[model samples]
Target: MHAFVVGVAHYPYVGKGLGTGPARRLLDDLGQVTVPEPSAREIAEWLLTAPRQPDDPPIGTVEVLISAPHPVKVRASGGAPVEVESAVHENFRAAFRRWLRRCEASRDNVAIFYFCGHGWRHGDQLLLLEDLGEDPELVLANSVDLGVLRARMHLTGPRLQAYFVDACREVPMDLTLSGSRPRALVDVPEPDGPLHPVDAPVFFSTAMGHSAFGDGGAATPYTEGVIAALEGLGACRKGGQWAVTTSSLAAHLQNIIDWNQVGEGNQEVRIEGQWAGRGVLHSLAGAPMVPFRIGCSPPGTPLPERVTARAMISPSPVSSVQVFEANQGHLSAGFYEIDVAYPPDSRFTGDTILWQIDPPNEVLSLTVRSRLPDRS
Candidate 1:
């Protein structure tokens, strides 16, 4: 599994430098904070959370981080200068190296990469906004070319590939309260197929097109969203690969802040041989990867995965009720390995009905706190 980031804020940015401004913005966005200052409570909330995406069962070993934060400082809509410094790329590179070392543990065994600079979208094509774009400093794609990306994912083994983006187009726009919300999706069309045998899963902080907002000090919406959805959720264990639905986490982020960037949808790749449709799951060890079938039932949940059970007892005067733990993300009716049984809750305590589970051991019970809360 790997994590890649590309942040661009300022360049030739009123001649302020190169990468510092956007670097801060990237950090703040991943950190979910704003410049000059951010909320303390948000910081605390993000700090306590952990990475919730399941990526375990060791697929060989190679973690990479690409940092491209080219500061192209310019005033946002409010005449406020965005802080982007070229030197910040060096800082992020060092941070990424350290991060790679900390996660991979074996220095000699890890694959590491970091880049930061300016990027621009020319029609459907995404290009770097580096000084070289004008035929001078030699600009390269800050967001690597799909051709290069394919070459890279092939090396990621057939396991999983995870992605995180905190980038927003360096364009200008005005915010309208009553205005239509930015479409949650921004798509860059593929030449043909989306199925990539080397592709596993991807998790992004924000959608494309939209600008991501973060106070100077907090994590950006993307990182903040990851932290919030994963923290204390008790979904992960040591050495396990986890696949989360983009929609579920996207919904969670809606309640946090108004994330500026609206990312494009999934991009599958092309392949050949009998393994043509094979995705990155080919390299996933232990359990076989279940491909997501549109409109059809998805793969079943692994037996080892812990399930989050949400139930409703129908607060009405009914004496009997059913406890349903929705399959939601890929878990199914057949996956409930735990034998859930209930005796009955004939007693109502303080306008509340206490429901009970069986075996004198089932821990789930409904409180009379005004019938059971229905998490519809």
Candidate 2:
């Protein structure tokens, strides 16, 4: 497999003192933040080092392009001024084109593309690059169109291609939020004929036109969720084997972003593809760890008669507390949920609940709080 990761943290013309103050103000109003360059490094490192299936071949090459303002003091005749350095703006296109050519010849490997940056959607997703557009006019000349790239990748016959984007598609001054949720779905022409063979799966950090927030000291919420899923935080077993696939990873990421208050439901992750079965990305090498999913109201949130909950346990969960038994006959094995309705007068007193599993028995504790008396 081949992996290419791009992270852009500094835009020359979109921010402070660049003759485009309005653009910066709009970005701030829309909740845009500078993406951390370490995110690119971390993702590339994982792609290079993540455990692959036991029989899968090693990744041939991992390419990374971190686009950020690395200050370099340049001495001039009058004085010294600082210049920003970036390789993505200088060589990324040529390097990627070369790789695309190679893909035409090879035709049988997996490919991964990850981009974390500022972007806008105008008929297509446009990745903002380093070039300084006409200030105030703000023509997006130095940008990459995601749709065009996807179409190009379709021509290259790789077994699988995966794309991850962490960017807001909202254009400045574009207040309309109608049709803001970005969808990666592809429509079919007919009902049952042979569909187009575009074996690419994509994951977007935010719904259409929404901003993807960045953490000050950590990776963006989206990348953090991806890292957690890849690290087996929410892994599930299938057919007695511990593994992470595109489907499972997507589900885990969505659950994390939605249930953990990661982005308060603003930064929703969406995954789209058409693979018949789960596409395995990594295999847990005999690690005796039980992966499970849990979701409910936070500890202090109001308690309802019917608190909805869902779970997926790998390697068989022994038992559960404050919940029902696992239905072994489920079409999708290892999946369980809690939909029990409590009596109207039932008394509850506790700060937490427990979920216990075995083999390497571990208990997961979830804090809870009853609804406070109504204040007049």
Candidate 3:
């Protein structure tokens, strides 16, 4: 497997004094971000240390380009930490070429691409690099045209390719009015030979004209979802083993994201392309631990101060009980007898609910209602 990751957090001409005159003003609204660099680092670390199945090919290389306010260092597999290249157009082109060459060496290789940073939509998705407005006349000279890149990837040898784009897809008015389009790094020519059949799935963080959300000093919400999906949350029992396929991963991502929202506006995840077959991204050695959520119904129902929730596995050799006071918890795939208790002083009652937790990242909201006294 070969992975290419790009994270741009520092745009020199966005809000800085890198470019003079009108070109810099065009990017006034696109400010510096603090999440993409860390998000990319986390993904790279996971790829370096993640366990691989016996039948799966080993990870050949993880190429990362990060643009940050200060120099950044990353640790490769079994090696000392080294400084990574900046996410400028030249560096990205060079690094991507190297990564693509490695993927072309083996037909059984898997190619993964992840990008997190400022982006715009103008008929095609434009991924901005560090030196976006470096040239006064050509503001988008350093951006990348993602649409062309996906089409050009068909020439590669890797049959399985996945792309995770964690950026906004809002259309910029300036680009549309000025009739400027971003340029693709690779020049794709008409195919002459039989193109290798590919199963490439592109996952976008948001829908068109929507902006992706992220907190300062933390990874973006979409990045967190992707990592969780990779860590067995997206796996499901298929044929005798647990595997995370393209379809299952997409479903789990939406479920997990919806469950995590707390009064925040919904972010619709958009997925493009389809798998040629069942594209298994990751396979687990055992049953996956599914996430379960429990809450009261009727929008803002009050609960007792001393409420307790317990889940006991059924038909098990040994008695096992998991207790929690929060509304969310993780449990291994099994049939469970859930019991909730409330304080006598409170006007709420408890009930025993039966649940079957089998799906990956399964989110269930167990609602306990209040018992009303009879007038009679």
Candidate 4:
């Protein structure tokens, strides 16, 4: 698998104090857990040396680009020091694009993109890059759009693609600006050509319009859970090796954050896109349990106002209740019918819905068919 990883704690032009103090301070204290550097480093480490059963296919050439500032100093023979300026937007963007080129050359491989930094989602998701001094208001231009990035990477035709974003999508409300909000440097262009369907699973630390917590003085709960899960902990053992699909890992990651009460309010982690049956992320040794499959239909069915759908839980008796939106209903030992009512104002056209089952931390994918006649 090839990886492009970035973690940023500072932006030179965006005034040192941009967002919430507590949150910023958490990141500043590198040793205090919620720091971005450690999280980025650990995640890259795991991907580089992914643990697998001896019988499983050996991992292929793993390439990575990590852009987080480390305190390590490098001295040159001529007395000049070599410093890594990772946060610069232009520098990081070049590195990211280079990684994409390498990935394109190796089509038959798994690709992963991990970004942990100060970011906010607008139009698409943006990862703030360190750039030469530019207007603070034009931060968007210096940033990279995750949606566009995903599309470009999808063109490489990797067997599997995974994106992990660990950043706060919160806007800095207290900032003094010349206008209501800043505009993106490059106007987000209309898709003039065919759009590639994103089949990879994307994971976020928190839901929309919320913040993710790092280190209450330890490894931020989100990254810690991910590391533990990837390390073969809490995974179901299958055929002498631990079994964990990408979907199952998503549920497990969510459970870890929720159980630990990581973030404030409803800091639910979200998993989007599709993962085939037990989309095997990696298999190692852990607790022995078979990962169950959760299925929904008519797959990408559309809804007008109210719709009835079926959810089938394999191996039966998974959970007492199924959760969607804010409502919950009891599930029998097997399949159960669910009635969903979409609000009139809810703009769910071409959107993925997150369905969860407690006790058995399982996730099912369901899509809201687009309403536009052409989209249908």
Ten-residue region with minimum lDDT total, candidate 2: 326-335
Candidate 1 lDDT (Cα, 0 to 1): 0.29
lDDT of 2 by residue, 1-376 (tens): 7776777776655534433344435333432245547666668667766667765545776656666666322222244432323534445576566556655456567677888877877776777655534243343445676776776667554756778888877755532222122222222223254434645778888777777767674577778767766666445676677666676676667765554463465667766654533666666664434333433346544333443334446765445423423311112222344343434554442333323342211223334445465589
Model 1 regions lying over 4 Å from their true place = 1-55, 58-119, 123-143, 146-151, 154-156, 170-207, 232-350, 353-376
Clashes of each: 65, 3, 0, 9
Model 1 Cα shift for residue 140 (angstroms): 6.3
Question: Judged by TM-score relative to the true structure, which candidate is superior, 1 or 4?
Answer: 4
Can you list the residue pairs that collide in candidate 3? none
State the C-alpha lDDT per candidate: 0.29, 0.56, 0.78, 0.54
Best by TM-score: 3
RMSD after CA superposition, every candidate: 15.6, 11.3, 3.4, 16.1
Clashing pairs in 4: 34-214, 34-215, 87-130, 88-130, 89-129, 89-130, 89-131, 215-220, 242-284
What order do you get sorting by TM-score, best first? 3, 2, 4, 1
In angstroms, the error of model 3 at 72 is 0.7
- Distance (Å) between predicted and true CA of 335, model 4? 25
C-alpha lDDT of residue 51 in model 2: 68
What's the CA error at residue 288 for candidate 4, in Å?
A: 6.3
lDDT of 3 by residue, 1-376 (tens): 8999999999878765544444555678788899999999888888888888876677889999999999988887788988999999999888888887888887788989999999988777888999888774688888988877777777764888889999999976677544445655777888988877888888899998999888897888888888888778777777888887777787778766765775686888898864663677888878778877666565577543332334444444246677767657788776777777676667776566677786555545456677787689
TM-score of each: 0.36, 0.64, 0.87, 0.59
Q: Which regions of candidate 4 fall more than 4 Å away from where they truly are?
A: 16-34, 54-85, 171-198, 216-218, 237-241, 262-266, 285-376
